[model samples]
Target chain A: MNASDVVTVASSVLLVLGSLLTLIAAIGVTRFPDLLARMHAATKPQVLGLVLMMTGLALSLGDSQLGWKLTLVVLFQLITAPVSAHMVGRAGYRTGKVRSDLLVVDELTEDLRAAREETDREQAGR
Target chain B: MRVSGSRKWLEKIPMVLWLTVLWVLFWGDLSLANVLAGALIGLFVMTVMPMPRIGFEGRVSFIGTAILLGKFAVDVLLASVQVARQALRFGHDPHGAVIRVPLRSHSDLYLTLTAVLCSLVPGSIIVEAHRLSGTLYVHVLDVPAAGGIAKAKADVLAQERRVLYALATDADIAEAGLPPRPWKRGRTDGPDPTTAVGPSGPAGDDQAVTR
Candidate 1:
């Protein structure tokens, strides 16, 4: 086989694997019990899938300019995915979307309680 | 005061150069004309919308950054499979928990980087971050599988330590109460197994039985 044929085969494999990962991530989002859990599904495999697919595309194209663009796509996703996930998780926690009964241990609730009590005590002293 | 003013401008150069490179990349052609246009646009955007200055007091370590990125790629791969398994295991339910981890570093840059890294890693997400206390509240998809609360907390601390080595000054490392990074020694000891166990049970407890 020629060099181009090998590149084509490798790219095809990567593309298939990446798509499978994305499908699993979607399944995870649907099956997961809570908002926070769902966000994990949305961010993790989804980001990795994008990276893999981008790599495949870059290889198949074999153009430096297109490769740079593909690199940008992965870089932007890596930077933004976590920020979006954090925002969603934080919002879910504040809006009572998180199921406390499902959790084994919750230190955030305990710390929030302590903080509130401290504030209340300070106000009472004043 | 004048020296500090120039230093602030110097700090902005990297931001501008990054923007310029992004602009050129988006344009798809690397030429003198494209670079000049990108630089011009980058300058325009910077002046039009100034961002809050994020002080970076530490120098970058090439070895530390390589280690950080290399380990991160591995973590993402392993965790993605783990989460995928949890999803596919039809009869099983993943026990989730929100555990607070107090980080040693107080710098905004380190804290933000740590939080971002933690969230992107598959099984964990940052539900809340208490800036004053330098604590991150992370929600883990499967606590027992992740080795437990103590293990999860240690992972986060380990991440923060890597971040410090990648960017924080030696003085900052000392301030955070961590020993000097052994860059030349490489591949330090693994997490202490005794401390890795959860409070309620031994770390080896089965997934269903633990919770």
Candidate 2:
């Protein structure tokens, strides 16, 4: 009814939504078939869910200092999430954990093959 | 040449301001004393650390930037809903695929930005990036057909065009083989679609779909 009450309701809605999204992300991690798909589940929803939760907390607190702190959390998450995913994906690929069949297109393998051929030709020339 | 030196220092102001704000937030206070201390710490950090020089070779178009941001926000919402649907599906195997996208821009900044943006969206994540060829290997959910692969590549190119419009130099634009203006829809002048390849079928060793 009041302004403060409206803020409270909105914040509460955001918190619930954030929590649900995170729960879905967890379910996705367990349910997804391969490492690549699992990485998708682990990063996407988790980062967005955290952002939503942070935003909700910022709104509820109503303090500018706390708001900026929450913003910092979101910023760092955004920066780090993709980098970490890239690392894990690369590791999985190198370790042969990724299903080659699941890959609809694989340019990396072709590139590697080409490089290997070039080196083989150079060795033969010697 | 005289103003260039001062301009470089001026450019660092935004980074310093951001650092100061971060410091204030870390301390959990907005008092005058905290603000002063934060400023001092920010100055110290800036002096101690040699920050990477950001390429701001092009003019900033505020309207273009706003449009890109708006598009990104909509994409995030839509992609999240789509992923959530797939996530909650009961007793259904996920048909995900990794697709390779050949980008037009060779710039490291562009490649990095594109990867981050794609990963931020729910359905796609960049697994490997080839810097030499400016290609990205993206793992995507539900690529049922060849057309689906095309659609994914198109989405990434569209995002790149938006980014170029917002903050790309003329040289960057030329490198990407785009016109000075925003890329027109259905423009066949861009990179050839044939370069973008998806597997016709399972390559080798088709294992059971593990869930």
Candidate 3:
């Protein structure tokens, strides 16, 4: 009924929702067919879940100082998550971890093929 | 020479301020001593480890940034649910596609930001980014769910447009072959919606695959 009570209830709801999202992300990572798809599960929902969990924590703590630190955590996650995901996806592709069978259309292969041919032609000319 | 040195020093101010802010935030206290200490630490760190300067010539638009951030949040929420549903649905095989989308902007800043934003959204992930050509090879989680290849490419371009609006200059926007600022436009007829999503223009730059 009171303001603090309402804040507590909201934070509790956010905590549960955030946990559920993170759990779904875990399931997606396990169930997705390939590395790239798994990257999606590992990165996307996890980001929103982290943001939600951080917001809930900050709200529950009721300290402006802690809130700023929590904001930094979310900011750092937002900045770094994509970089890590990109690196993993690139590495997976290079290592042939991506399943071509699962992909409906692939354009990168053609581009890579053309690039390699151009280099080969240059080497032949030399 | 002196002017250039001073300008360089001026350029370092923002970095210093940002580092100092981070330092203070880490300590979770705002006092005169903390501020001074943070600044000193910031200056020390920058001097010790210099980073390559990223070029930024765009003017920031508050409204555009608001739209970008607001839509980004919503996209994350909705797409998360979509991906979650895809994962939960039993026996459903999601067919992904690696579609190359040639972005309009040539700048690395916009390219990186667009890549980062696209990666956060569930369905599309940037598998490879060709810096020279400014093309992003995105892997879509579900081709049909994403409304086909053209739709996915357009989504990436749309993300770039929102990014350009937020930070890119009007000249850069025009250079990218996009219409001028929407707020400043007088004409209702923008570039044909078809061309906006159309296959590679007259340039013939995007020639990888067409279906």
Top candidate on lDDT is 3
List model 2 lDDT by residue over A1-126, tens digit each.
999999898889889999999999899899988888788778888877897899889889988878877888988998899889889998897788988776666666666679889999999999
**Tens digit of per-residue lDDT, candidate 2, span B19-131:** 87887878778789888888888878887995876444454445557878899878887778777778899787677777778898877777888888888887888888888
Tens-digit lDDT string for candidate 3 (B99-186): 9999998999899999999998889999999999999999999988899899999999999999998877667899999987686466
Q: Interface RMSD, all models, one decimal each?
A: 1.1, 1.8, 1.0
For residues B104-182, could you state the per-residue lDDT of candidate 1 as single tens digits? Answer: 9988889999999988889999999989889899999999889988999999999999999877766789899998767
Put down candidate 1 lDDT per residue, A27-96, tens digits, no spaces.
Answer: 9889888777778778889988998899999999999899889989998999999888888888887888
TM accuracy, model 1: 0.88
Q: List candidate 2 stretches off by more than 4 Å.
A: B1-11, B25-36, B145-147, B182-211
Rate residue A5 of model 3 by lDDT.
96
TM-score (C-alpha) between model 2 and the true structure? 0.82
Pairs in steric clash, model 2: A104-B199
User: Which of the CAPRI classes, incorrect, acceptable, medium or high, describes model 2?
Assistant: medium
lDDT of each: 0.83, 0.76, 0.84
- Candidate 3 residues lying further than 4 Å off, grouped into runs, are B1-3, B186-211
**Residue B115, model 1, lDDT:** 92
Clashes of 3: 0
Off by over 4 Å in 1: A124-126, B1-5, B184-211
Backbone clashes in each candidate structure, one number apiece? Answer: 0, 1, 0
